[model samples]
Target: MSNKQPESPDSAEIFERITYLSGKAQQMLLDFWTRQEAPAALTGDPFGMTSLWPAMTNAALSDPLRLAQMQFDYMQQAAGLWQGFLSGDVPEGAEGGAVRDKRFGSEAWASAPAFQFIKQAYLLTSRYIMESVGALEGLSPREQEKARFFTQQFVDALSPSNYALTNPDVLKATIDSGGENLLRGTEHLLDDLQRGRMKMTDESAFEVGVNVAATPGKVIFENRLFQLIQYAPATETAYEVPVLIFPPWINKFYILDLTPEKSFIRWCTQQGLTVYVVSWKNADETLADVELDHYVREGFLTAIDKAIENTAAPAVHVIGYCVAGTSLAAVLALMEERGDGAKVRSATFFTAQVDFEDAGDLKLFVEDSENASFYGELSEGRGYLDGRYMATTFNMLRANDLIWNYVVNNYLLGKDYFPFDLLFWNSDATNVPAKWHAAYLRDLYRDNLLAEPGGISIDGTAIDLSTVKTPTYIQAGKEDHIAPLRSVWKLTRHFAGPIRFTLAGSGHIAGVVNPPAVEKYQHWTLEGTLPETLAEFQDAATEHKGSWWPDWLNWITPLSGEQKPAPQPGEGKLDALEDAPGRYVKERIA
Candidate 1:
């Protein structure tokens, strides 16, 4: 109305169509819409998609700009295909080349999506060239032309092969910096593609599928939002010692019980350990009132109390991973100070941090005034952290692999989509309550209260890990980015009880789930006692050349009683319980 160009109705319609198609394609690959192993069909690798498919596909499919960007990039690749044919790099003149020639040599190639991408890239470069020359307008005409030519040369030299060798040092740095495998793995994929070792497939969206989808036995403990799954012991009977596993609410608990061969839960069950996992209800806006303390009280402590009441055992073991590990440490510290130590016999922390001093680069978020302010504003209106935004931040942390690799593949190669389990899990993000997240950032990261005796409080009760006298086994990864190993080791100094510290071979997820089958994996040594510092410990400890799973088994076996036949249901301390491994199946909270 004010002399502005009218909105493109066609563009909007096309965008909507693109989104719908992408989503449909994604669901097909995910097997959410149909049963198919998209990754295996495309890459011939069952594990290829792990956690990247859904992530990249969802980004492209849901957002109009992202979808458009993808379309434009594909156009550039079409140009390259044409150029390859014209240069005789692709066959178009031989006996069978007639068909190929007809397909690739047509004038219609100019309008192809791949060609459009090249045009777009060329235009962008042209803009940069103009800007560089305009800044030197006072220069001679010869100098201006040279500047333009040099910029063109710069773009030409930015090919993948040349770039790889040019930044070998930086590329190798990730291996030591905890992000090596992620970056290197992506480079390997791209390398295979460029070398023609692997054929490029059509990738349109992320694909995820249920690997071991099973109906949980039944729900024994039902709440308004949570239905705890009942699990029958895999063996004839289970241990008298009751155990509860509390995984981070962001993911499904089934990650721990992923598969029969790789499942930690199944392994523990076989060890005669009665296990129950706390599958936290996912938090949405309506669940905003559910704060951190509520999780501690209504969620964790309640479960613990119930376990103790049912088992009538002196105490139980609680294992927490990542953020849930922090929660476990807090609960243990609180219970001990209140002279309620009888409910907990031991605690095992998997990459948990009670100290914030060496919290790693993640501290940057809480420290950045601008970022924190923006987050605070977002949290105020949302009542909880946006699940997708949290997922995006994590993805950004590994930009080279998660962000750029996808860019080149989808835009440059015109690759087809695939299904990946890990990517699906990664994409399945859950929101955190604003109150809890805010307090967590302020108290733990900003104030470093959890480590201090009276720094952080829960309803007037101080959280001091040092006060916890429970025998503990703390395991951390040497290459963990989220919770640095050093910060995890600091817990040893805090607990007065006998403690065992172990280091694994890989980064966060792989390290925690180290199945002993990993290639050339090693662990820190164990001598007369665990070392005081993480650095000193690494230097002194021998690198055991195998998966740490066997070592973990041996270590925990002693803490647990011998392989005595477990009592039948309703016969031991846990006699009052409904069943073993009760009401804790994996499910998405809608």
Candidate 2:
């Protein structure tokens, strides 16, 4: 590695080159037995090179001209870089390199002749590969998406920032710290190895009840599946109908209650909305046999009933996030089938999908139904799918941001990062019952049955979304990888209600949790008839400023009924079991 330090640039160019790559294959192997007695959830086969290689083969054989052009273009760029290195008159923004690239932002990458050549060459090659993948012919849509995604994974992993030899910053850090940064990084790596998890945020910097999930509330009801917490009134008066939120069990509910400034739950309370959040219990061996029917009956119905009973309201306005949103759709259908649809006055879905026709990168985990038993095998013994596997999968979806940035920052540069509430919440995982997960993947994910009439039966009750005439509000993030906008938009066709579809600015979490005050991201809404495609929707939709919270309030307020004195936690049927952000949230994987 060069001893030279990275010099300052006029302005950092954020490159399109993403910094990230492969999960430590070693960690996956090492954690097998050390993973304790939990179930054997399917993580994934290491991005099938099989799919990618075929595309490469097809490109080379089918379009020799395209290949030649790509090589020729790369060569011209490489030659220009060589010329600039020799002349010592390198153009700072060669080929309009004005865009800021974090991976190659350092002036060392710009000013240094050798590094400049490396940077531009890598960029050219990356562009070549991406274009080739996009243009590759003779693959199904699923195969094409897989090829594109896996190619990106490999390209990102190979980013120059990941290595001390290539990344001037890392090289400088190693030299400045007399190689001690490397030692510290090694120690961090080992610590993570021991803990069997990646340490993203300063874990000690925040605690669940004290700081992160500190919204004032009390656990009023508990079952084998979840704890229902009713937050204290943040206003003197409240809407007659209470709000019950069922957050995705994929992670803890604290995401909705990150901090006082960021907490959606707090914001809801301040709006004179009575809020009740379901805190799902981390699954264990005892909960292995639990299935979708069990979740619908015990988790969703019970929580809805509790929220209504506590407020003595005729109905509750229900909101579901992610998977919970998907599950809640079924429950609504069940309610409609049983003549209990009146229990829910209106429904709000956050980044949820009933139609799996285009479920995004996540569907790769359950691509083939012939491998259906393989999913079952994953959860066969442990009875539950470990959340770490899910977390890892999610991280891979945006490997450059979630996984690789930390690798370069913590592992490469040995830098200590400030506490991030979102990362902290992300690292805090929850296990899912095996049977429930298998059924979920098989039915909704693998089979794409949720959107069909009578496709999914919970306890012999057919769940057809068309029967669900409850008024609905749906929010889908424009850039949500887990639940793509297109997939979420299909919900417009399934539910028989007045659908107020809104597209938010960011991805899943940031999009939904966006508060009105901070005013970070924007959202889009269509005033007229809903479009047939997401592209059409985006085109016709008017983009609004800041968060979508206010817009949602504007829509739901009319349906929420008249304001009355806000009821405190546990004012009715159920007694206060414990303080808010209850024990279920505190459970961690052993």
Candidate 3:
């Protein structure tokens, strides 16, 4: 204790102090500059006599009448807008493009001319700034990306939805609640601050296995990396080729089996296909050294072995969603190297991209500098990336819907959180092992390695997608921001076998989980040879009503082989560990 040095300020405190001092210094500098310029500005030579006159003379000579007319038009528009506000005759606000966008749709916002004007002004200003930034010259690609990102962040932060006084709904709620709403909101904010992150949904509204992930099944196999659940068959005899699902480890597996009505697992079982899903364990400190090889070996390969043994099927049909599809493709490459490629009869990828060349907006976060900073910050304690960090990044991609919507509801209005199953699933996230995450970013995202031959090795064999010849069915969401349709469509170039690509309506999660019973959303399908480009495919595709699930079932059923008696859970050496939606899924990192 005597030898110990005195405590110093933490990084956060240091940054706060630096920010305060810098802001104060900036204000002082502005005041000094204003004082210096005051006399010149009053004398009407603020920009300097020579420069101001020359610039005006050049402008007048160039196009004086057009410039004058443009200025007059802008002034007239401004005056009209102001007059409309005073007369309460402002036009309706622009419609928000996002599905969850109700910011400009409310009667309150439309009725208030001031709010209407402000909203329109904000929209116009943000659009102009964004367009200007996009058209900026003489900047490197990376600098341009950074500029766009920060500009968007500033625009989002300044949104009327984020402020109480400027937001009509929030103001109305404040008045109606007699100031109690703000008190409740304060409590909510304090609670979130203490918890260290915002709660996106009412976590208490649904319980795992009780209401959600309630499909009847049993954990038939377990390994260090994942647990395989074999669902109880809805039909007596199932397809001879068992269907195994590899869901993305970034999320809990129950996203496929949220509830009976919408559950893809239940639908599969009902359609006479024995379904087995891999429920990955949420990573922690003890599992920090887990690498990509371990996942391919112990997680996917092992699960496939167990499923084949239990069902006594020579080959199985595989479905991989999101990152799992990427992993499956890698696994297939490994399998091809091992001469064991025949074990899988057919493959289906749900919104997964093997090629990362056009990975969409997510590429912005995968740059060298940003990736390095993320690695350093996340590797500090447990050597694992916190689930909340991933959740926050994804949420920021859609700030208006995922972040600010809840902020207003939970804090400004003091309303109870809506019990949405999808949002609940979205909120329940899982951590990623540091080693695996780093490798994934560097190899797949950064280097674009997976698509190249010998770019990556798993279990001592180099992974190459070209060698994978399994008949493939690829599904992509047209509106998916995470895995863009073009990125998903790139898989056709690498695969040597017959491929069927279906483009679905909606986004990543909703597109894949869509059940036919809902009878919502449309999907596009095209027969004959795949097109050379995404645009051509879209142009030639035929639109079909209803979910893509039914279309998928129709496509796979033909290849599934003749029906056989459904295999019982734990028929092989692996005994049934527990009921469906087992203990592993319930284990949260925090």
Candidate of highest TM-score: 2
| Candidate-wise lDDT, in order | 0.57, 0.83, 0.79
196 Cα displacement, candidate 1 (Å):
33
Best by lDDT: 2
Summarize candidate 1's per-residue lDDT along 97-171 as a digit string, tens digits: 223322123332334443333333344444443443344433344334434444444443342312322223223
Weakest 10 consecutive residues of candidate 1 by summed lDDT: 200-209
Deviation of model 1 at 455, angstroms: 1.2
6, model 1: CA deviation in Å?
A: 46
Q: TM per model?
A: 0.62, 0.89, 0.85
lDDT of 3 by residue, 518-559 (tens): 888999999999989989999999999889888788989898
Model 1 misplacement above 4 A: 1-218, 222-230, 368-372, 517-520, 562-590
**Better structure of 2 and 3 per lDDT:** 2
